[model samples]
Target chain A: SAVISQKPSRDICQRGTSLTIQCQVDSQVTMMFWYRQQPGQSLTLIATANQGSEATYESGFVIDKFPISRPNLTFSTLTVSNMSPEDSSIYLCSVYSPRQGGYTFGSGTRLTVV
Target chain B: AQSVTQLDSQVPVFEEAPVELRCNYSSSVSVYLFWYVQYPNQGLQLLLKYLSGSTLVESINGFEAEFNKSQTSFHLRKPSVHISDTAEYFCAVDQAGTALIFGKGTTLSVSS
Candidate 1:
């Protein structure tokens, strides 16, 4: 099992500002994913962070808005840019499964925009 | 595209009673089904998963879910409920080991 850690467990930001959430895994994973959960909603795949390449974002999410960086295996970051109250949600980092058995998740960053 | 459907958005049950959380999915090809639990102020943890072989899977905590291919369902069940079981449960489906499409999530509130 891999131990995943996320920085800034939570933060409240002002509108128009950007907040970057970092995810660090104890071991290298085959695939790393980012997810967003809006209040009273389900988890949505935001993007897939592949090391040394551009992040593959899902439809409705743009790199310009949610830039992702995977400096190396085991380390990744998701930046929510030009934040608005609508951007307020919980961002989570997850590892693709059964390597750690099922899916291991980071604690998540709870961001609230003013 | 694969999608999951959790019929109930919320379910309230008295502690020690039986509870069931329904989950259904739509996928043309083979897929993996999973149940996850999220406690307050915490991250989601996998409750169980159905990869292959047997259609029945059990979690360590006495939670069991059956994979009904004909019905396209993987519903979670616990014979007895507890206040500690109050949490948000998510049903997810993944085609292969790739992306996962999650259901809206069902909040299970077990009260005393």
Candidate 2:
């Protein structure tokens, strides 16, 4: 299984600010996905990070609001732009390893926008 | 696309007691079922999965689930649980070559 190191674990930010979450995979992955889990809610897909190309965002997500960068096979970053209190949630990056038969998720970034 | 349903939002059980967490999913295509456990302040860990072959799958930590195609259910069960088993359990489904769709999750509270 591929290990994903995601930071900063958690952060408290003021409204109208931006935060970027990074996930570095120990090995190359077939696919990388970014998800947001609202308080007391299930995980929702934000976007799929594609290497060397623009990320594919989900229906409710937009490039301006949630921009994703996939610089290489093992690295990806997701930025929440112009965040508000509603944007507060746990952001997680997940990677699918073919050999593992499942996805490996990062520890997640708990962002609290006040 | 697939959608998962976890009937119980929370389950309280005594330590060393048997427990079951019900999960049901709907998908038009062939789908894979998986159970994941998330501890407090941590990421999800794959507990078990039903990719193919036998309908029964077991995790290393004594948790097992049966994939029932007719019922569209993959309920997790443990004959005996410990306090360490307390956590949020999520049931997810993925169509072949697609992203996973997760259920709302069930919080299991194992008390002494």
Candidate 3:
């Protein structure tokens, strides 16, 4: 199983500010997924980041709002731009590991917009 | 496309009692089913998964889920749940080469 280190487990930001959450995997992976879980809601896929390519955003998610960066196979970052109260949620990164036979998730970054 | 449905939003049970969390999914193609547990302020952990061969998959923590292809269901069960078993359980499904689609999740509260 690959270990993931997510930075700034929790953060608080102004409504107009932005926050970037980083996820580092112990091993390289082809794709990384970003998900958002709003208060009392289910996890929703934000986008799929592939190394050296533009991210593929889900239906409701836009690149302007939730920008994703996959510089390499082992690392990715998700940025929440122009945060709002509604944007406050738990952001998680995941990677599918063939050796683990499952998806490995980051600890998650809890964001609060004030 | 794929989607998962977890029948219950919450399940309250006494310690050492049997419990079941129902899950169903709809997908046009063959899919893999999985059960994930998320403890308070923690990341999601894979409980068990049914990829192929066996219809029934068991986790190391005394939890098992049976995949019923005809019914399109994969319900998780524990014969005797401990207090530590209390957590939010999510049912997810994915096709051969896609991201997982998760359910709303079931919050299991076990008390003594």
Candidate 4:
């Protein structure tokens, strides 16, 4: 199973500030997805990061507000641009690990904006 | 495109009791089903998945679910659950090699 490590497992930030979350996969994955789980809500797809290309974001999410970068197949980063209280949520990155028989998710970045 | 529907927002049960979480989906093409568990303040872990084989799948941790094609449902069940089994469970569906669409999730509470 591929192990995914997300840096800054949790953070508290002020509104208008930006936080960058990084996901590192032990093995190269063809597809990597970024999701945001609002408090007590289901996980929502934020974007799909493709190696060496611009990310494809889902509807209701914008490239300007949630910029993504996939420098390589094994690593990606998502940055919350100009955060707000409404952006407080858990951000996670997952990669398909055949050995895991499912997707392997990062520990998640718990963000709190005040 | 695929979408998942989890009928229950929450379920309460006692230790050593049976529990079932219902899930349904709508998709035009054949899709894969999966169950994921998230403990408190944690990331989701794969519980089990039904890709192409048998409709019934079991997790290493004693959880099981059956995929019903006719009903478009994949309900999770546990005969006798432990306290550790309580968590937020999500049902999702995806194409053979595509991304997944997750349900809202059901919060299972196992009491003493």
Residue range A1-80, candidate 4, lDDT tens digits: 88999988999999999999999998889889999999999999898888987888899999999999898889999999
lDDT of 2 by residue, A1-114 (tens): 789999989999999999989999999875799999998888888888879889888889999999888989999999999999999999999987767678889999999999
lDDT of 3 at A49: 93
Residue B27 displacement (Å), model 1: 0.9
Q: In model 1, which regions exceed 4 Å deviation?
A: A98-101
Question: lDDT per model, in order?
Answer: 0.92, 0.91, 0.92, 0.91
lDDT of 1 by residue, B40-111 (tens): 878888899998889999999999999999999999999999999999999999876687789999999999
Residue A67 deviation, candidate 3, in Å? Answer: 1.0
Q: Enumerate the candidates' DockQ scores in order.
A: 0.72, 0.63, 0.70, 0.65
Worst 10 residues of 3 chain B by lDDT: B92-101
For candidate 2 chain A, which ten residues in a row score worst on lDDT? A95-104
Instruction: DockQ for candidate 2, please give it.
Output: 0.63
Model no. 1, DockQ = 0.72
Model 3: how far is A9 from its true place, Å? 0.9
* iRMSD in angstroms, per model: 1.5, 1.2, 1.2, 1.5
lDDT of 4 by residue, B6-69 (tens): 9999999999999999999999989889999999977788889998788899999888999999
TM-score: which candidate is best? 3
lDDT of 4 at A88: 96
Question: Over the stretch A9-107, how does candidate 3's per-residue lDDT look in tens digits?
Answer: 999999999999999999999989999998877789999999999999999999999989999999999999999899989999999877666788898
Model 1 residue pairs with clashes? none
Indicate the residue-level lDDT of B44 in model 4. Answer: 88
